[model samples]
Each structure stands twice: as structure tokens, then as C-alpha cells.
Target: MASKKNININLKVWRQKNAKAAGSMESYKLDNVSTDSSFLEMMDQLNEQLVAEKKEPIAFDHDCREGICGMCSMYINGRAHGPDTGITTCQLHMRMFNDGDTIFVEPWRSKAFPVIKDLVVDRSAFDRIQQAGGFVSVNTSGNTIDANTIPVPKADADKAFEAAACIGCGACVATCKNGSAMLFVGAKVSQYALLPQGKVEATERVLNMVRQMDEEGFGNCTNTGACEIECPKGISLENIARMNREYLKASLIK
Candidate 1:
């Protein structure tokens, strides 16, 4: 028999004209924000306010508001995907904040992930890294094998499936002080290296992926484990270790 009161909040958002242009924090006040609204929904409200006032609306990347796409690259209040664990920005609810809280919203901060505009960054670096080696060059074109029929150990299959859960959100890099992408790269490498179909390309896969990761300006793993902490999917440090082993084994190949 009670109605929930909507809260008012302030947003200190990063604004950039473009990747080449200068940027700054612009402030906005929002009132009566529904706690039930997801973070992206609140952002939509803010954009609507800006548009209604004839100002440039804040631009943020988001798709599958369901949190699967990992496109909501909002670094909120110094935490990737907001101050939450195991969730993306699109999954964050307004109820997480207090009535008068001032939320600092910024794009994914990394040399590789340059800012495109307010709360949006050029994460194409991830795409390039994935393209470098995130695949198996199997000749299953006409003779596709039933994956279930393939003989695979349950343990290896489990690891590969877990590794495949990575959604490539770049939170691992954003939260990292060194801006490292070890977790993301590790997951990619592990996903394939654990499977039979990908073993043939293992040596080349790890080498190419690691080389491209460095070329993309991603830093080396700091060993601080921040990536695992902020990762929305909880991709483990084991994958990073596995990748390191793969890289070492690849490098040792004369």
C-alpha cells in the first residue's frame, strides 16, 4: 500500500567532441529518477533532457539491454560498469545509488580504447585483437563434424566452455591501472587452446594474438588481478596463466 519515491541525482559526465578534440566533465542534475530503471535507461532520460533543451545529447554505446553485448562501456564512479561485481552497466539499476548521489560517468579509460564522445570509446581495438587469432581454421566447410561426436575430455571441454563465456567488454583493461588486457586475451587464447579443433593453431594463435595485443597499445599484465575483479563475466586468472603458458610454449618453438 505504498508508493516508492523516485530519487534525484547529479551526473558528472565526460564530454568529448571527438577522438581528436579536447574533453571535460560536464555536470547535469536529474530529478525523479526511478530506482527501477536500469543505468542505461537513466542515461536515456538524460539524453532526452539534453535533446529537449536543444543541446547535444550524451552518446553512450549499448545493445541487448540484457547485458550480453557488453556494449555499455560506462565507467561509473571509478569502477568499470559501475560499483558492482558480475554485472554490466546495462544491468545496473538506479537503486544502487542514493537520492542525492553524484555519479561520475566516463568512458573505458585505456590507450587502446580512446574516447569517441561522452561515455563512448573506440573499443575497436578489441575487435582487431579478436580478429588476430580468436578462431579455428578448421576445414569443416563441407564435412562439418558433430561437436558432440568429437572425442573431448570433460575437463577440457569445461574449461573451453568457461573461457568462451568472455564477452569482450574491455572492463578488464579499464579497471587495470596498467590498462592491461591479459584477462580478455587470456580468455580468447584459452577458449581455443583447450579445444581439440584449435590445438593445431595453438602455437601461432597465442603468438599472433599476443603480438597484436601489444601492437594495439594494451599493456602487459600487471599481476594485480584487477582484471579478474572487475570482469563482468568473472573470467578467472587461470585463463591468464594458461595463456602465459601457451605464449611461452609458442615462443620456445624453434
Candidate 2:
């Protein structure tokens, strides 16, 4: 729906050639901008212009164009993904901007998430943390069990689903002043803790993942709630509380 109207804007985009390179914000200008373009689409337009001029295109990550993949992440105007609620960067529309506006875009900033490119960071730290133990450990023998065999309380199921909605986008980490991934880790913990299939390994999973999370050089969460506020999935602080309890119980058991 974005139509190129007579609008002008300024962009301050973080540019880096590689992980070891010193990064800095490079400014760009836009003219006759479309108000309905998604933020990524705007970047695409910019890339087109740069290509035509035989200049290097800005680098960023994206896929699904929709918000589900959690791949498109950018710190826009000071917020993770953008100035939007319950949406990822791909879903962030240009309509959020105004004419003659100045927009700042940057990659996720975290010690564990080293910069991969201009506006992309290697978020594989999350994968490592998950590998610590974020799954149900059971060999698949193709035995189908009745859904009713393990009766999950409605409340727990709902909470599990809510926590499961986290897309691992690292927005919580990016927005947190401490660069804490407690929200992300908490959601993962809560998702497994509340599920019947995951209950068997709940104690071990929480302890291991939390340990890996701490070892990743991320800061401790002080519960500022900025993570929940900025989370596209609206994952709650309650998940963090649940994770804390699970971790304590896990420690005691160990």
C-alpha cells in the first residue's frame, strides 16, 4: 500500500564491514518516500538506489517479509524492531514514520550476539543456550499417545502457549539496558516447564539453560520490564518469575 509521495527523510544506519571492523552510523537521504512501505521495503528501495549508483548496498537480514520468522531485527528510532507493538521488523510499516523524519537503524547489540554485517548480528548464542536443554528428551519410536492421556490444566496450557510464542528475535536482549536475555530464556523455560511432555526434565532443563545463559556474558535481569514492553510477542515478566522458581527448585533438587 506504500505509494511514493513527496516526502523526504534522513537515515542514520550502522555500517560495518565485518565483525572486527569499527562500526559507525552512516547517513543517507530519501526523497519521495512511500508511507505504506514496510521498513525492510524501504531498505530495499535504498539498496536499489545504491545499486544503480554502483555503490555498496546496505546489509540487513530479512525473510518471510511477514513478522513470524523473527529474522528481521533492527533498532529503529531507539526501539527494537521499530516503534510498533506486537510486531517484528518486517511488519513495521513506513506509515509509522513522518515526512522529514530522521530514523536510526542498527543491529542487535549484545556481547553474545556479535555483529554479522551492517544491520545483522549472529544470534546463534540463543541456539547455544537452547542446546543447553530446551527440549523434551525422548527417543521417537512412532508411538502416538492419546492427547487426553496426559491431562494438562487449561491455565498451564494457555501459559505454555503464550510462552511458546516467543520467536527468539533478541528484541528483549536488544531493548534491555542490561542486555539481559532473561525474558527470552524465561519464555523458553516457561514453555517447557508448563507442558506435560517437558515436566520430566523441567528441573534439569531450567538449571542447564540458566547456567548456559549466565555463561554467555549476558547481564543479570533486574526486572525493568522493558523487555516485556518491547517484546513483539508480549511475553510477560511472569514467565521470568516462573523461571526463577523453576531454577530454585532445580538447584535445590540438584
Candidate 3:
């Protein structure tokens, strides 16, 4: 094993007192940052410096720094979840930048994702969308049948699992020029639509979810494919196509 080298860098961080307050990019310098440190760890160091100086620390959202929580939302250097691809902010490393590089960190931007503070946005719209139609009504009583008894095609099963991998991070929406959430909504819809247990309410589920997504004021997908490209989970655009089909079928049947 080799010792990782350390370097100094400049940070351009967003600071906002609250949702109603004005925000701006504030510059700070960091010294001897190790390349091995995760991006969030570097942020912790920055906060430590601010607190030591009696200045209010930057506020950001993060939980389960392992990247599963999807709560660590940051737009860094004009890209969602930093400049990395297929990874969340927590997964980004200091090594990605050069010693003299200046990094800009901002919150996810969208009409649906209002900034709650510096580097933090209200993502509860996703929760509302899920509440609209993200589940299967299962009887948990003793009369419930075994899941294995109903065999599903391997292809559908794999695809459903892939769609289920979405962590509900708003990167797809942030990266989309139109601020569209089609990828996120599509993944959620596809996860259940491909499964037999989800077939019962498949029609209603897609319709309600899409309707709720629109009501939240997320922009429409224009098929530029930025959402799929920047998705941390690599959730496929195929899910979007599947969602469109489901929505069409539901519209016709209704």
C-alpha cells in the first residue's frame, strides 16, 4: 500500500440563512486535504474551520454517507452529485480534483425542490409522489400466499430489481435542463409494474404517480437523456419508456 498525497484546494460554497433569505457563493480555502478523503469528509473539515472561527457552518443534507439514503444532494461544479457519474455526493472523493482546483457546491435546483438552506433542498415532493402510488396492497394475514409460489419471468424480475435500485435522489431532476423527474418516477413505477404482485393496481399506480409528479411542478421529459446519464444508480431510460407505456395503457382502459 502507498500513502495518499495531500494538497490544498479552494472551495466556492453556497450560503443561505433560510428559504426566504438570499444566497450566495462564499469562497474558502482548504489546506492539506488528503486525496483519500471522501467529499463529505472534506466538507466536515470545512465546517470545523467555520465553527472554530465562530462563523455559521455551511448546512447540507446527508445521511447514510454510504450513498443509500440519497439524502446527500449537492450540485457541484455545475453537475448534480458533484462532477462524478453513477455515484452520489458521498461517493465522490477529493482525488477527483487537482490541488489548485476551485469547486462550487450548490443545492439541487428545481421548482419542485425549493432550497431550504445552503446546499439543502426540500425533497419531500418525492415522498408525496410515492404516497400517490408507489406500493402494492398486500394482505399480511396468515392467509397470504407464499411469494415463491407465483414464478415470474427472469427478465422481468431482473428489470424490476434494477428499477428498485433507485434511491430517490433528485440528481435526475437537477441534471435535467427541464428539471424533469421522469427518470425517478419511471424507476418507481417500473419496480412494481413488472412484478405479478404489482399487476393488480398497475394501471392506477402509473396514472396516480404521474399525475402527482405533474402536480408537484416537475418539468416534462424532453428525451435529452441527461437524467439517465447523471443518475447515481444508473437507472435506465428504458424505465421511462416502460412508464410511458403503462400510462398509455391506463389512460385507454380508464
- The root-mean-square deviation over C-alpha atoms between each candidate and the true structure, in angstroms, is 2.0, 1.9, 1.9
My TM-score estimates for the predictions, one after another, are 0.96, 0.96, 0.97
Residue-level lDDT of model 1, residues 55-96, one tens digit each, is 999999999988788888888999999888999999998888
Q: Which candidate's lDDT is highest?
A: 3
Against the reference, the lDDT scores of all candidates come to 0.90, 0.90, 0.93
- 207 Cα displacement, candidate 3 (Å): 0.8
**Residue pairs clashing, model 3:** none
Comparison by lDDT, 2 against 3, better one = 3
What would the TM-score be for candidate 1 when compared with the true structure?
Answer: 0.96
Error of 1 at 17 (Å): 1.0
Instruction: Give lDDT: candidate 1, residue 36.
Output: 88
What's the alpha carbon RMSD for model 2?
Answer: 1.9
Candidate 3, residues 7-76: lDDT per residue as tens digits?
7889999899999999999999998888889999999999999999999999999999998989999999
